[model samples]
Target: MKWSEVCIHTTNEAIEPISNILHESGASGLVIEDPLDLVKQHDNKFGEIYELDSSEYPEEGVYIKAYLPMNSFLSETVEQIKLTINSLKLYDIDIGNNHVSLSEIDEEEWATAWKKYYKPVKISKRITITPTWEDYSPVSSDEIIIELDPGMAFGTGTHPTTVLSVQALEQYLNKDDLVIDVGSGSGVLSIASVLLGAQEVHAYDLDDVAVESTRVNANLNKLGNQIIAKQNNLLDQVNLKANIIVSNILAEIIVQFVGDAWDNLEQNGLFITSGIILNKKQLVKDKLEQQGFKIIQVNEMEEWISIVAKKVL
Candidate 1:
């Protein structure tokens, strides 16, 4: 099999919204590579291991995003994705109209390129996500561990958005709350929600890789039965409201989701969102306020912002 990918370089502020726009136009979820994330790969002396300890990681960078296709390839899908980008006036973003093609390699072979980079990261007071093949145990007196062999998904627990989402899930959820993770990348948030004490967690993402990753990580955490990973874009299949909703997605999706996010919340439900840049926090805040969600708090780390809001009745 063969595949095609269209990548664009955009400022961090434009990446997520453009990704969502591309996804809506037939491209699947995109790969986001913030400049610092790319740089960290080269700084072997202080690379990934340093990210585990907050003080070690670099603070800011631009973003690189690639829209991917699978099974069969379609030029029209690629064109539409590009058109959406152009039509929306997504700033500081550009890509060749030509799609990059690749011969499909067996999954195992394809993943080796990443092994040199994946490392065990302790994300919370009690939780750690360790990739398979790494030999680091949490030495902290009683740290809980979630081991994973992540392939092509979102939950490495390294991104501040992912970390903040996990932290917010821990802070807001209780033993009996029903939680939903809207963009359950790598299933990290869903797994964390269960580990944090939610009675159950339902997760959805448009990316099959992410859905598969969720399942893999769920088993890693030994909560296979408690976490349900499904393929639905942003609450499309949901029928019931949840006590907590966590979305660590781009700010524009946060804008588009604010309405549905408000509608799918149980009374007083908490909506925790990340993947927001420091420059555009007000755009999202304005949208949430328009949706009748009251901002409860803002968490910022190295220019990334996570906002916690309550759906106002």
Candidate 2:
């Protein structure tokens, strides 16, 4: 079988939204090549080694590559993807170069080539994300291991935004607490919440692909019973009071649902938001504050930011 490798030259800020666009268009097995990964020093406290090849990375902007089966509707699907991505500019998202190109490759090549880029990555104090194909063992008895099959999802669950969300969950989530994971891509945060002792989780995503991916991943970790994955827009009509609400979506989308988030969270419950660029930090912070949320912590990783807000009122 043949596969079309659709590569987009974009910015760090556009990663989440563009990836969503591709995933919604039926693209699978994404590969993100960022030059920043080469220069940035990763935290090796967990003794995980990161090996990156400079030749595969762009010298300037980030490169997002996804695999789509070459079929009769391939052209139409690609065009629709391009249109949807361009629409992101309406929301003030920086798309950077936005140069999209395509190449034909054999399925055999794509099946294994992208897997080399993913490894066992320790994102937080207790959470570690490893691909299903990799053999990894915990360095400590208390370590939390999350096995993800990237082929079935948009990411490997090690993106900075996801890392920050998982870290916040580690810090704020209580045992047996109910967690609401908005924009639950790959259901990584929801899985992490369960592994960290949450009794149950409600995972919601706007895209059906993401919803199914969440379910598949949840079951991959033997956590199917604890996570309820569904398709829903950001917190729309969600009335279940949660002990913790976490969203790792773009800041633009994050602000649109602040009121709903506040209404659904229990008093003194935590609202953890990531997928924010540096410039949009204040935008989300102000929106959360306007909704009566108290800003408790702000963390930065690379060009991304995560804000943890508490429902004080």
Which of the numbered candidates is closest to the native, going by highest lDDT?
2
In terms of lDDT, model 1 sits at: 0.69
1-313, model 1: which lDDT tens digit per residue?
Answer: 3234455544555555565565555543234555465444422221134433333222443333333445444666666665676755544233323233333334444345345446777665667778777887668866767677655435467666777787777677889888888888778888888877888888888877668778888987799999989998787647868999999887767787788888889989999999887876999999999899999989876578999999878
lDDT of 2 at 205: 92
Collision count for each candidate, in order: 0, 0
Off by over 4 Å in 1: 1-48, 51-110
Q: For model 2, how many clashes? A: 0
TM-score, per-candidate, Cα-based: 0.73, 0.97
Q: Among these predicted structures, which one has the highest TM-score?
A: 2
Regions of model 2 farther than 4 Å from truth? 43-49
Q: How far off is residue 251 in model 1, in Å?
A: 1.2
Candidates in order: C-alpha RMSD to true structure: 5.8, 1.4
